[model samples]
Target: MAASKTKKQVRKSQFKLTSEQEADLRKVFDIFSKGGEESGYGTISAEDIKIAFRALGYEPKQEEIRQLISGVDKDGKGLLDFNDYLAIMTKKMTQKDDVEDLQKAFELLDRDRDGKINSGDLQSVAAELGYFTGTMAEDLQEMIDFADKDGDGVVSEREFLKFLKKTTFE
Candidate 1:
C-alpha cells in the first residue's frame, strides 16, 4: 500500500539531561548570565559565549560566535536565557537519524533550490554558517572537486545523496 501523505511523521525523542547534568548546566548558565532567573535579568550574551568557547579550548571567529549565539538566543535579543541554553544543548546533544539529518543539511546548503550545489553555492552557505575566510573559495573548490563524482564541477542531488550514504557508513 502507498503511504498516506496526510499522516504526520513522528521524530525521535530529543535529548534530555540527567538531574546531575541539569544541575551542572544550571550552574554554568548562572555563571554566564547577568543575574538569577528570578530577578528576570539573567541572560548569556555573545561575549559570554565567546568566553565559554575559550574556556572549552575553542577559538572561534566573531562571525562563528555570533552564529552559535543566534542558534540559542531565541528572541534574537543578543542573549540566551536558561531555557534557550537548554534548547541549544538539546540540539547539540541529539544524535538524529543519518539520512534525515543529511537531507536537512543538504536543503539548507542548497540555497538556490536548483537541485545542485556548486562552489558558489557552498561559499554562500559557508558564509551564512560563519565559515567564510580568505581561503573559503579554495575550500569550496576542493569540496566540489572531492564530491563531484560526475566531474561536472558541481554536486548534483544524486551525487550529494551518494556522498551522504557513504559518509554515514564511514
Candidate 2:
C-alpha cells in the first residue's frame, strides 16, 4: 500500500516582506517559542502575545491584541502560528496603503466585525482602548454627532474614513 502524502498549505498574504524583515521576524519568533520543537511551527497563544507586547513596552489593549491576531491568523484557528506572525510583521513593517491602514483601524473600532460602528461599538472601543471618560451615553452621542455624517445612527466605512481623514488633516 502506498502512503498518501499531504502538502503543507501556505496562505497568501496581501503584503510581502524583505529578506531582512523575514530574518528579524524569525529572530523574534525564536525568542517567543524557545521551548517548542525545532520544526519551526511554534505557536503563541493570544495571552502570550499580550505578555510579549508588554515586555516590548507596548500597553496594548485587549481589542488591539484581538485585532492583531484576527487580522493575521490566516487559518482562523484563534492562535498565531509561525506564518501568521510573519504576516503580522509584514503588515507592520510595510504599511504604505492608507486605505488598508484605515480599514485596519475600522476593524479594531468595529469590535463585532459588522461593517459599521454604532454608539455601542464606539463605547466598547473607547473602553477597550482605555480612553473612556464622562458618561458613556454622553460620549457615544458626541461621537455619533461628530462622525455619523449620514445621520444614519451608525458610522459606515466611508464615514469612518472621512472622519479619520478630517481629524488627521485638521
Candidate 3:
C-alpha cells in the first residue's frame, strides 16, 4: 500500500488510551493550559501545544506544530481542547514510538556506525544474535536486497524505515 493510504488509514482508525494514560495526558494539558492569565481553563494555545509535546518527550519542528494545530484546531481560534489535544498526542505518540523502535533496530544492525546497513553489518548483527548459520552470507545478502530500494547493496535509514513500514503495515 502507498504511504499516503497507510497514513489515511491510521487517521481513520481509533486510537485508544488507557485510563492511566488519559489521566497523565490530562495533567500535562492542564499544566500548560493554565500557564498564563489569559489562558483558558480547558484550552491551550499553539505555544502550549509545543510545550506540551516537549513535556511528553517530543521535539517537534515548528512546521509540524503549525500543521498539527491547523489540522486539529477546529474553531481556528488558535486553541485546542482536551479532545483535540488527546487526538494529537495519541497519534503523535504512536508514530513516535514506532519510529523510535525502528531507529533503534536500524542502529543495532548498523554496527559500524556508518549510517547504512551493509551485508557485513547484517552478518555481524546476526552473529551477535546467534542466528549465524553456515548459509548466513546468502541470508544476509537477501535481507539487504529486500530493504535496499536504491539497489546500492545496502539499506540506508530511509530505506529501512520505508521497508519496515511497507512490510509491517501492508
User: Pick by lDDT: which candidate is best?
Assistant: 3
**For each candidate, what is the lDDT?**
0.69, 0.69, 0.83
TM-scores for the candidates = 0.42, 0.41, 0.65
lDDT (10s digit) by residue, model 2, range 1-170:
12332211111233466688577667766668634648887887666776665543446678867887888776776678777766655544443345567889898888788899888888787788897776777868788778888788889999998887667523
Q: Candidate 1 residues 1-170, lDDT tens each?
A: 33432221222242457798667667767778886667745888767876755543445678866666687776777877777766655443342344557777788888899888888888887788898886879978999899999998988877887896676433
lDDT of each residue in 1-170, candidate 3, tens digit only? 45556653674475578899889898888887744434444777888888899888899999988887888987888888888888889878777867888899999888999999999997787788898887889988998998888999999999999999778756
- Ranking of models by TM-score: 3, 1, 2
> In model 1, which regions exceed 4 Å deviation?
1-12, 37-41, 53-64, 95-170
Model 1 TM-score (2 dp): 0.42
TM-score of 3: 0.65
Q: Which lDDT value does model 1 have at 96?
A: 30
Once fitted onto the true fold, the runs of candidate 2 whose alpha carbons sit more than 4 angstroms away are 1-15, 53-59, 72-77, 95-170
Shift in Å, residue 101, candidate 2? 11
Clashing residue pairs in all predictions, respectively, total: 0, 0, 0
> Whole-model lDDT for model 2 versus the true structure?
0.69
